[model samples]
Target: MPRDQILTFFSKYIESELGMIYSESNDFQLQNRLEEIVKLHNFANIGELYQSAQKGITGSLRQLVLDVATNNETSFFRDPKYFRAFENLIEKQIKGDLFSDKELRIWSAASSTGQEALSVAILIKELKQKYASDLSFSILGTDISERALEKAREAKYFQLEVQRGLTTPQMLKYFTKNDKDMWVASSELTKHIQYQKMNLKDAFYPHEGFHFIFCRNVLIYQSVESKIKILSKLESSLVDGGFLILGVGESLIGLKQDYETIMLDNAVVYRKKQKILKVA
Candidate 1:
């Protein structure tokens, strides 16, 4: 098949299957990725690759394409200031009368390999030790990749994954080094988090109403129309007065009208506006 035809075919397939949009300018990169898929699938050429993909031998091949096309580059505490602000927000929520119990529910919307969710759990544990409160919290981490979720379930990290945003003290307190010299998150920390596969484009929301949501960086890949739809759905999933934290570079501007942006000392977080009850 001609390069242009191959690019066009794959581009449309990706957009329809994964909600990914690629342009002709990305032809070289796309071709390289497709060539890798061809090798992996044992296709003789691009013609065979497309035919096999169309015939539904594309499940594994599709995952590879989505994994490569989507940017899943993430780190523990990728944004420090946002986390600091998160801690403060949790404390304030606990102190407020709005919530009768010390129950906090948080969701890491695109938790890739569980670092962000685990980090939040660790912070909660640390806070519990200091305050001596019987606080109940749940951290739910979801990603679209089954492979990534499997890694998250392992709760083990290579040297490189461990080096990011983890301090020596944290390493000592929350992790154990195996004989292989790899750092594994302590079972206690991993116990609080649950990892599941989720597609943000789908209408289904996590069952629980979230007190805090970290949907940072994932929206950049989505189209503006998709962004607005997803953000609106996310707002509905949040509790009244609940906080939504986005990537520093992301914004809700021209997206939704229900959330009010609050600038904290460390980060800017969005909160759903409280609805006032009118007396008859």
Candidate 2:
């Protein structure tokens, strides 16, 4: 078969499984990204890589391909503007009957390696001095990558990963170096997190009715259909008036109308619109 035909057949297969759209406009980008994986796996070229993907690619290698296609740019307190908004939202939420049992629940959907989720915990801890008198919180971080989830469960990161969004004071207070010289979440910070593997395409999540759901930077790889389905599920899974924070570059346009946009100083966030039932 010719090269274009082969590429077409395989791109469709890849996009079907991972929902990463590639076309004439962005084929070069995909090819460039796949080049490194080809070299890493010792494949001669794209042709051999496709053959391996068709039959011989291991589960882990398939995941790597997906990761390469979907850029997972994340870090602790990534974009402080959003963190500031989140803190303010939490403070506002506690002033009313929003939470029961004095417990705050947050879900870091597609949490990757868990930095984002831990950042939320750190913010909560810092703010506890003022309002969290008897309240407690739990953060649930979900991702499709088992390796990422393993690292998240370990609560460890390399120096560069830790430095990306962490300040010197934050580095000192919330993390310590391990025997391998890797920075890790402090003992206190990990207590509130539960890392698990979850695919957003699924109809049900492990937990539901989250007070705050952060599905940041994960939707860029999804198809419009997948986006609509997942966004709808997320909206329904939130407590009435609960928060939904998307990535700064993302918008809920042409997807679903389950959320009302809340413009903030730093970033844009959304609130699940509570349905008011009219008596029949």
Candidate 3:
């Protein structure tokens, strides 16, 4: 097939199937990735691959496209400032007689491979040991990729993945090294976290209310319209005055007015406005 035709097919297919938009300038990358798919599917050429995909000769191939397009390049504690801010938020929320519920529920909305979720779990464990007594906490990690969720559920990581965001003491406290030097998260840290597969663009919300949500860096890939829609849904799922953390580069400044932005030391988090109760 001609390059223009191939580009058109990919543009429409990606946008409709995975909510990804590929521009003309992405020809080289798209061609390279498509070639990999073609080789994997045993297609002779790009044209053949497109034809087979159109005919549904390979159902899983379609899913593969979506996966490749949406796969994120992430690491443990990609942003340290956010974690610091998170620690402060937790401390402030639980210090005085403000809430005093002693129960905190957190959601890592785009927890690619569970590092962020596990990181939060580790921090919470540290906090519980230091200050809060008999605190109840749950951290739910959700991603759109089943494969990623499976990897997260395993609670094992390569040495490289474990190296960042963890000190030697933290590693010794929360992880065990296998024969290959791979790090496996301790059962204690894993106990508080549950992994689930969720598509943020879905019509209905997957999880219930959460005290805090980390959806950083994921929305940048989405269109502005999609971002607003997803943020709106997230707002509904957050408790009033609950916190929403986005990537340092991501913001809701001009996107939505429903959330009030709160600036921490280095992180800017959004909070839904609480409705005041009126006395009769």
Candidate 4:
């Protein structure tokens, strides 16, 4: 059992390190996650781990802590309605000449294990077949967890993982079961995605002009101030009039200065205001 001091200190450290907040209500939860790491490292108690963290210990242990602390919960086509809105946006943009030769960039800002990004790729493949043969998509999947990104790059998943939001048609259409009895995304389906590590709090955002961004389900972990800042950066990175898809429950509320809410069947879609007038 971890002592009270250890839990308190650990929670604060996690908040500082990763910008994830854990309060006294979450002590048991924190203890549960920490205990696994504690046993893995063969530490006698949580105190030793605490000491190591305070000493600025850098290694697998710290990385594991941050990785586990993050909510890596994701699945293909997570919140199906968002994908519907996405499909609608794509159809709209392509008709406006946004699909002409130039790469259609979509950023899955916190793509856990790449399911969401791969889902987008699959949808694009379908769209390309019908609307524009030459339309090319460049999907970028960014996560703070290197471990998650590694799995994403691999694009392999167990039966249960793929079952979350994929239909039989989608499964048979886009993935193949491997020797290990796991389903792997087909090369054709994954051809356009590039996975990389990015921290939302960091000042430097490397790429921009994305036509669509699936920055979903990640902002709930951050404080309001952090959410505002992150949303601002995400907004700035998008091409003018590009769409930003947040998780189903997340909203700009008093926060959407440059975005307007567009309601879908069961989700909120934020579209960035256009920079200048273009004759229709």
Model 1: per-residue Cα lDDT over 1-280, one tens digit each: 4558768988887776656667777788888878877787688988888877677636677787766666677888888999999888767655664455467888999898888988898887888778776788888898887777888888888878878988888888999989998899997788788888888888889857888899988887677887888888898889888889999788888775579989987688999887889999
Worst 10 residues of 4 by lDDT: 92-101
Candidate lDDT values, in order = 0.82, 0.81, 0.80, 0.84
lDDT winner, 1 or 2: 1
For residues 1-280, write the lDDT of model 2, one tens digit per residue. Answer: 3447655765676677656567757777777877877887788998888877778556768777765665666899987899989888777656654555468889999898889999998888877766755468889998877767878899888999998998888888999998999998897999999988787877687556788999998887778887887888888778888889988777898775768998877678999987798999
**Can you write out model 3's per-residue Cα lDDT over 1-280, one digit (the tens) per residue?**
4568876887777766545567777777788878877777688998988887777534578656665656566777678888888888777765753355568889999898888899898887888788955667899898876667888999888887888778889888999999987899999989899988788888787456788999988887777888888899898888878889998788997795688888887788888889899999
lDDT of 2: 0.81
TM-score of each: 0.91, 0.87, 0.91, 0.92
- The positional error of residue 28 in candidate 4, measured at the CA in angstroms, is 1.7
Q: Which is superior by lDDT, 3 or 4?
A: 4
Worst 10 residues of 1 by lDDT: 93-102
lDDT of 1: 0.82
Clashing pairs in 1: none
TM-score winner between candidates 2 and 3: 3
By lDDT: ranked, best first? 4, 1, 2, 3
* TM-score of candidate 2 on Cα atoms, chains taken together: 0.87
RMSD of each: 2.4, 2.7, 2.3, 2.8
Compute the lDDT of residue 69 as modeled in candidate 2.
62
